[model samples]
Target: MTEILVVGASIAGQTLAYWLARHGMRATLVERAPRLRTGGNGVDLRDEATEVAARMGILPRVRAAAADVRGMKFVDAADRAVARVNMSRNGEIEIMRGDLVGLLHEVAEPEVEYVFGDSVRSMEEDAGGVTVSFEGGTTRRFDLVVGADGLHSSVRRLAFGPEEGALRHMGHYFAFANADSALGEDRWVTMYNLPGKMAGLYRSGNHAQAKAYFIFRSAPLAHDHRDAEQHRTLLKEAFGHETSWRVRELLDGALADPDFYFDALSQVHLPSWSSGRVALVGDAAYCASPASGAGAELAVVGAYRLAEELAGTSDHQIAFRRYEEGHRELVKRKQQIGPNVRMMVPKTHLGMWARNGLALSMGLLARSS
Candidate 1:
């Protein structure tokens, strides 16, 4: 049996481990967090992702926990609805990120060895295998090492290079945190924009809790990505004084939530997903940005393809090349974020008005058709 070390127990890592275990391989997963990270915004599952979930026997559970968001409505300062876009589509289900992660963990737990509260400190790849050093001062060797860690992947830095060389900034920063369900209309995502900033509330009828979303246009700022305090301060500075459209209440809720997530709107673009015996999957390799609405989909499909290739071949090089070749087109298509960010956070009042008008027309056309 091949012993594989998978860093990060999130969507990509867990899915990869699960598939590897099913292929009769031994997988050990290490996560920096003490436990599974079950908090994040809603993620969509569609196309190949939905098929992957069904193969794992978790599709029914995912459907049952679907967020069931109807559409997004743009509102003005007085909380008047300016325009609404019906996001309802066939064959796609949106589930809270935490719920999906939990479901993935449940199915993957039985066959995989999990190491929580620890992470890979360093790794050295040789002809036979890779030797890994953990943050807890432990050392181990595995036949293969995989980095399913997110954008700031330590494994990537250790194997390929630093993040500054790969992360492409998308001219914005975004945050997501728990919110009071009462502040939002059930089954709708309500957003308010002020110039280049946007504050939104997402409420899912299937879930009792709501999620607050904040996005603002900015160049890259200096801050430790891992520092929670810095994240809080940056978010506060961006929207702390805003007094329109329940912005104050939303900010308070976001600040109060313990699992608040803040990060630059960036995508990972690596020339290669593998270096020697180590390979990367998901956001660690090709993050299409949350704006693309394909993070989960890509994670699922990419991880599946990677594990499938590894299981089929003895040469890690061939497997890695096949995985990259198979998935690059999808990544390329999704990376072209186009006008998503601009539409969500219009730069001026005229742009906002134009966006609203376009959204209204889209809604009308959908109804008419």
Candidate 2:
């Protein structure tokens, strides 16, 4: 029986634990957060990830919790709809990030051990196994340690070295939170954009609340992601005084929401996602940036492939190589879409106008087709 330690009980970590447990392997999942986090922005299941979800036996649950977003309305500063992209229920399904994580966690809990409010403090891996020290002053030895933690992965830092090829900032920042959907605009996402700035509201089927998303271009603000005060202040400075339609109201609601999430739009690029008996998965290894709109898809598919590869071989080295090989192309395609940030958060007046025009044209073409 191989004792595998998976850091971060996020979607990736949970999915990996579930698959490994199904393969008759015992895994211990550790999360720094006290418990499962809830109320995150909606994430989409697209491409091969949809099949992966079905195979995991959670596709129905995911679809049931899916946001009833009919389409997206792109608007100008004046709140007039410039374009609308009608989303068809074809190959894509959108669910709240929290819901997806909860589903994965539930599937993994009975089979795997879970430790909350703890994290890896240090790790040393050898041919025999990996010795891990936790921040709670506990030590454990496992046959393998996986860093499924997010972009700022402590496991990556401890096992792979400092943040040399770890992260690349994509020249933008995004923030989102749940709020009251008093607008009565159910089954639709409304978006307003200006030069280097974007504001949107999303309605989910599971709740009457709407989610507010704010994004802006910045030259990498000096603030810690974990600092709530700094994150709030950054968002306030970015769009605090903007006169866009209901922007003030949305920001006020966001500031009041205790569950607000703010982070830089960044990508993770690693030369190698593993060393010795330790390896990394998902965003910890290669985040394609939120601009790509494939984070959830990548996380689910990457975890599946990684666990499948590990099950195929007894040697961690071979498994890690195979996982990377299977996943590199997907990661590359997602990263290639990172530059689409300009379309989402245009930096100039002309860029904003062009984006609006292009979206309008696309919407017209879609209607015609």
Candidate 3:
């Protein structure tokens, strides 16, 4: 059996390991978090990703746990819905990120060795295999190493060099945390915008708890990505003074939540997904950004494809090249992202009015049709 090391145990890493083992390869997954990071915003699964989930026998579970969000409603300060954009598409299923992660874990845990609360510290690659040093002070060797880690991947830095050249800031930062369910209508994502910022509440009919999310336009700010306190401070500075449209209540609740997620709206644009015996998958190599709504889809399909390629060949180089070649077109299309940012956070009052008007027109057209 070929030995493989997969970094990060979220959707991508778990899916990769599961597929790898199914193909008669041995996989060990390492996660920096002590446990699974299941708290996150809703993610969508469509097209090839949905097919992949079906093959894994988790499609029914995913559908059952679907967020069931009807669509997005743009609201005013007085809490009246101005326009609603129906986000439901025929072939897509939306589920809370945490729920999906848990489901993936249930399927992957049996066949894969998991190392939580530790991470890869360094790696030395040679003709035989790659020697890995873990943060928990252990050394191991694997025929191949893959970084399914998120955008700020340690393996990418270790193998492909620093991320500065590959990371593209999308002119904004966003945060997501728990919120009071009563703040928004059930089964709807309610959003309010002020110039270049948006504060929203996502209320799923299947979930008792709600999620508060905020996005603000900004140039990149220098800060430690792992510092929770710094994330809170930055969030406060961005929306602390806003007294409109339930912003204060949402902010308060978000700050109180321990698992607040804050990150720059960024994408990874790597020239190559692999270096030597090391390779990258999912957000570690090509993040389309949240605005694209393709993170989960890309993660699932990319991980599966990577594993499939590796299983088909003994040559890691050939496998890595084939994986990238097969997946790059989808990544390229999703990375376009287009006007999603502008639509979410209009830069001016006139722009907001125009957006609202367009949405209202679309809603009316759909109703008449």
lDDT of 2: 0.85
- Show how many residue pairs clash in every candidate, following the order shown: 0, 0, 0
Q: Can you write out model 1's per-residue Cα lDDT over 242-280, one digit (the tens) per residue?
A: 998899999998998899999999999988999899999
Cα lDDT for residue 255, candidate 2:
93
lDDT of each: 0.93, 0.85, 0.94
Give the Cα error of residue 68 in candidate 1, in Å.
Answer: 0.5
Error of 3 at 128 (Å): 0.7
Q: Model 3: clashing residue pairs?
A: none
How far residue 116's Cα lies from its native spot in candidate 2, in Å, is: 0.5
Predicted candidate 2 versus true structure: per-residue lDDT over 1-369, tens digit per residue: 989999999878999999999887899999999999876888889878888888889899988988878887776666666666777668899888888998997788999999999999988777789889999999999999999999889998887777646778888999988767985367878878878898889986676778999889988778887899899999999998897688888999999999999999888988888888888998999988777878888889999998899888888789999999999988898888834778767888898777767866665313212
lDDT of 3 at 363: 61
What CA root-mean-square deviation does each model show from the true structure?
1.8, 2.1, 1.7
Q: Model 3, which residues run further than 4 Å from truth? A: 361-369
Give candidate 3's whole-model lDDT.
0.94
lDDT of 3 at 358: 77
